[model samples]
Target: MWEKNGIKKNKAQNYKCTDCKKQFQHEYLYWGADINIKRQIIKMLVHGSGVTDIAKVLSVSKGCVIRTLVKTGTQVNLKSSKKYYHKVQIDELHSFVGKKEKKVWTVRRAIIYAYDAETDEIIAVTAGKRSKKQVKDLFKRLNDLTIDWFCTDNWKAFKEVLPYERHLIGKQFTKTIEGVNTSLRNSCKRLNRRTTARAAPKFLKESL
Candidate 1:
């Protein structure tokens, strides 16, 4: 069926399988336009195009574009093996929903940023809902192997919830987190104006 649609088949070259040893034709299957569309989607994403924009350009649904991107293995890197930043920053940002007439609803998300303050390199990011319990849970889910200092603004929730593990609160201590919040806000168009309907919570979380 695929071969009838211009799919090409090549001889299996240097191919070995543990389950079975067979020399079968390796076929590449796709419609010509699909290849172009996929490349366009990837290129747009590389150029910092939002998912909605990519979908519009490709004439596909936003969900389809998102799933395709995920299938293509494009995702944010959240792991840092090196203990580059002993001190981490924490903050929260809110997103609003609803249009001109209806009252807007707000949803808050917590952002945990690990950064090398000296080099200004963002090492890792963890996001969750804005709540003492949620923030504490986020920390608990982290690998406790690294004992680094945590700094945040005088958010009383941090003082009460974060474990006694070298945490500090003060204006100076939270500068990095504040900077991160600014960067994150600007990166996602939905959050830039503060009045736009928030992106789906799951998508926003994944974007982090």
Candidate 2:
């Protein structure tokens, strides 16, 4: 059944099974570098290797790595019954596109901060461009029915966009959203790099 290259080879002779009396020919099936390659890819991802880096090192396409990771990663339910965070902090930050070329414009970014009141655990983060319309859209998407206290800085945009549930504006209250920014920067090295934003936006969104 084994070949010189360690692959299974097709058998030349046919044989009959004793119990079933079925005639069949033995064939050799092979498992080659593909399995080993997948294992290596998973290992590199565990070691904090970026998808592009893994693709480059493995000489495989980025799509392959992404598909494998997505297939293997845990999937969570999107629908949430809980509406409105007890203490939600909201803020925006700028991420640039070009560096070496002098004419670089900043991307106004927004993030929704949700934390569990009792556990103080960060629950969710929604990021997008900064705009009053966008902020309002985010709140609509959140579908939070019960927000106890929504905190932000003196950003008129938030004031214009957010609903009248319970909003607070003051200095030092936007720290939670700032902390989310810090987490995003630390976790995604690609965002911190001074390169053009060439990576696929879909993949970047998924990675986030």
Candidate 3:
């Protein structure tokens, strides 16, 4: 519980997970952070602040910053479908993830995005491998949209999932989504090359 002066009024309750038997604090404010402070942390993160940078800015511990990010990242509504659109562009971005003593794991964690041509908006984003099944699943999420045309690279999945009449296979047609990929790589440290911010699949997925 919190008091009128914005300080904690009661001791945190401890609850154990049924399956894991792990004790965790059940606090009203996540990690004992004030609501305003949490919002400021989120804003800083969106504006390209690294975890350590955010921690320093807020005068908090690095672990606090990381916990806030993990809590906020996974809570996002990623699968919300948009309204109908006539023109859309789709593309995939592949990158490496995971690690081992002998060798690093070369995973095909592709970021599939759909860009609305007329409005210059990114309507959808599905992160997974560049496979036929995943591609079809992404389009299925956008089935409500009346897409008359789709611009994409010469990926065989596009040809297999969508009708040829509606699909335009060319790099020239997918400049916007490519730009988005570049922006993501530039803004996110984990997505950058040769960075210590690299993460495994689960952490990477949530971070992005």
Clashes of each: 0, 3, 0
Q: In terms of TM-score, how similar is model 1 to the real structure?
A: 0.53
Report every candidate's CA lDDT. Answer: 0.57, 0.58, 0.68
lDDT tens digits, residue span 53-101, model 1: 7776667777666556655642465565564356776665554444535
TM-score of decoy 3: 0.57
Best by lDDT: 3
Ranking by TM-score: 3, 1, 2
- Score candidate 2 by lDDT: 0.58
Please give the distance, in angstroms, between residue 135's alpha carbon in candidate 2 and its true position after superposition: 1.8
Q: Give the poorly placed runs of model 1, Cα more than 4 Å off.
A: 1-43, 65-77, 97-111, 131-145, 154-157, 194-208
Off-target runs (Cα >4 Å) in candidate 2 are 1-48, 58-85, 97-113, 116-118, 193-208
Q: Per lDDT, what order, best first?
A: 3, 2, 1
Answer with 2 or 3, whichever has the higher TM-score: 3
RMSD of 1: 10.2
**lDDT of candidate model 1 versus the reference:** 0.57
Best by TM-score: 3
